[model samples]
Target chain A: MENDKQKFRLLDTLYILMMIVPIVFGIVLKILTTPQSEGIAISGAKIFFTINLPIQNLPITESQIHSWLVMIAITGLCLFLTHGLKEKADTKRQHIAEWIVENAQKLVIDNMGDYFSGFAPFIAAILSLSAFSSLLALFGLYAPTSDVNVTAGWAILVFFLITYYKMKCGPVVYAKSFGEPVPFLAPLNIISEFATPVSMAFRHYGNVLSGSVISVLLAVGLQGLSSMVLGKLPGFLGEFPLFQIGIPAVLSIYFDVFSGVLQAYIFAMLTMLYVAGAFPADEYFRRKAKKSTI
Target chain B: MLELAIGIILGSCALGAGVAMIAGIGPGIGEGNAVAKACEAIGRQPECKGSVTTTMLMGCAVAETTGLYALVIAILLIFVAPGRLVDILMETIK
Candidate 1:
């Protein structure tokens, strides 16, 4: 309990920081990092992707690096802020927590070691790529993930990682994955594998791309409404000592914080699930569930 | 002609954004579920509340991704769009 409190203090603080930094830095990123990307003409000439924000583009230009930095920073700060005490945990509670953590670690190590030595690197790469892409988009940056090229790269890496891990885990059955129970299905399986990356890429790219688009539009709408309805004629009418800024503030809260963090986690987790599922490694949580049920 | 053209682009963008936000239903439901589960877990086992909360938050965050994407697409469609082509096409037709 004591140790848990200490750990929780740091982690909770980190979470709070994570929740807050983006609200501030998101605005900052918008002004600074928005990319100056030119799209290619059909004739193979350069045309730029029009991103209005400069800083948002920084994460994109730097790919995953810039995004990770902000994410890590926010996380670190949140931990710093939420620092708690080291109280003694009872044996039962300590054992349970330790068991959960250790089991998870063991599963990860076994899967990564016995199966794909590169599993850790592969997952990290995918996560970094996504984190950066999302942070860019969140901050109103023109992002590579905004473009299909970067997304495709993400898909390709994921596809390869899945295949390599699968092959190592079940070389025979994996080979059988192609030219499986029936010959015709072989082509279909290939397509499915191919589709894995494409769908995964689109899913991540589409979500970030769409979220960026909507928040900006909503923000614009709210700002326009505020300027038109409230700011105008307020002084002429007799400026009420009580002003209501709450309506737009509520809208801003939902658009900026709640949705942004969720999207980043989803993109990263899907990548994790896809990679982990490929190895056919039984997850610790699921094992725990089964054991508890028994 | 220009006014009509701009209106068309802007209108289409707005329409598209509205469509994108329709996907928000997913995350809204998922987050609620996570919260509910977290509450239940907390009640059942207060000791592991911290870890449970973390896990719940992570799950909720993942759930929010789809909605976020919809927002991004809608934004692009509205503000940062391919310009002039639509206007030119409208002009030629007119």
Candidate 2:
């Protein structure tokens, strides 16, 4: 028992040392490299390609590259997880695969009702993509959701699905929905329909981008604060970024992890709700009415 | 004159951002209400906590959309519009 206690204490000390060493190194590097006067500049994604065509130059941005990386990573992980299958319930991989599939199915069925449960895979894919893309910012990658275009793309797809499902009820009914309760309200209804995609896209994009901007500002501000406090010290000690180590990590938990996960879930949930709402409610209501009359 | 125009632009941008952030009050109140109700529901029936929480979060996110729209506009006003306005002002003066 005594031996175990000593071993645990040594391990705990080693773990703390491991964490502290890198942070101290990072602080030294940051102080040595960064100029005091320059505030951190928040800018859009860097363009990697400018294909010179006769008409226009098509530029591929950092967000596009990062999204591709995220896609490849998810695909590779899925492939690795599902490489082998067996009748016997044995492997951990199989357990995880089953759990994921089961939860996805349940999420769609529960949120979208029984009729629209066919959309489970699609919803799962969007949720995974959005979550992964948003979380990528934690690793210093340009998050795809930070770019409006990426979120717009997803929103547009959801918009198309909603319209398609709505039209499936009947073209006349779909068109008449714009008028809603009164004919004069048609323009307002139409505008609200258009606003759906715009709002969805902007919400995700703004949340992720704002979180990133705040994180950057906080880091720069902390560095400035450290310099103000530490500059009184003699020589090399004055240059140390004393405040930069543990403080930003706490903020990062909220900005990167919480916001990233929440925004992704919100986007997916909104898409599911909107798409499910577009489905015809006539049959369900008619059945309920018949039951009541009986 | 240029300096005065610049000051006006900066001042208006700051005011616009503040005004835009005021939209946050609605969502704050709405989400707070939602959470309060959800908490009450959970307190009454602990078994339904998961579903209640999910529903509450969904409603809160929807409520947040209006604030987010305002935030986008505020960000544009503060960051993008001011720079362009100053450029246009300089051109006009020239």
Enumerate the candidates' DockQ scores in order: 0.21, 0.66
Whole-model lDDT, candidate 2?
0.84
Q: In terms of TM-score, how similar is model 1 to the real structure? A: 0.50
Global lDDT of each model?
A: 0.58, 0.84
All candidates: interface RMSD: 4.7, 0.9
Q: What is the RMSD of candidate 2?
A: 8.6
Badly placed stretches (over 4 Å) of model 1 are A1-148, A169-172, A178-192, A229-266, A280-294, B1-27, B50-94
Error of 1 at B3 (Å): 12
Candidate 2 lDDT over B1-94, as tens digits, reads 7799899999999899989889999989999999999999999999998889888988888888888888898888988989999999989988
Q: Which consecutive 10 residues in model 2 chain A have the weakest lDDT in total? A: A18-27
Candidate 2: list runs displaced more than 4 Å.
A1-39, A53-56, A281-294
Clashing pairs in 2: none
- Estimate, for each residue in A125-176, the C-alpha lDDT of model 1 and write its tens digit: 4454455445554454455455555676767876787887677535775776
Best by DockQ: 2
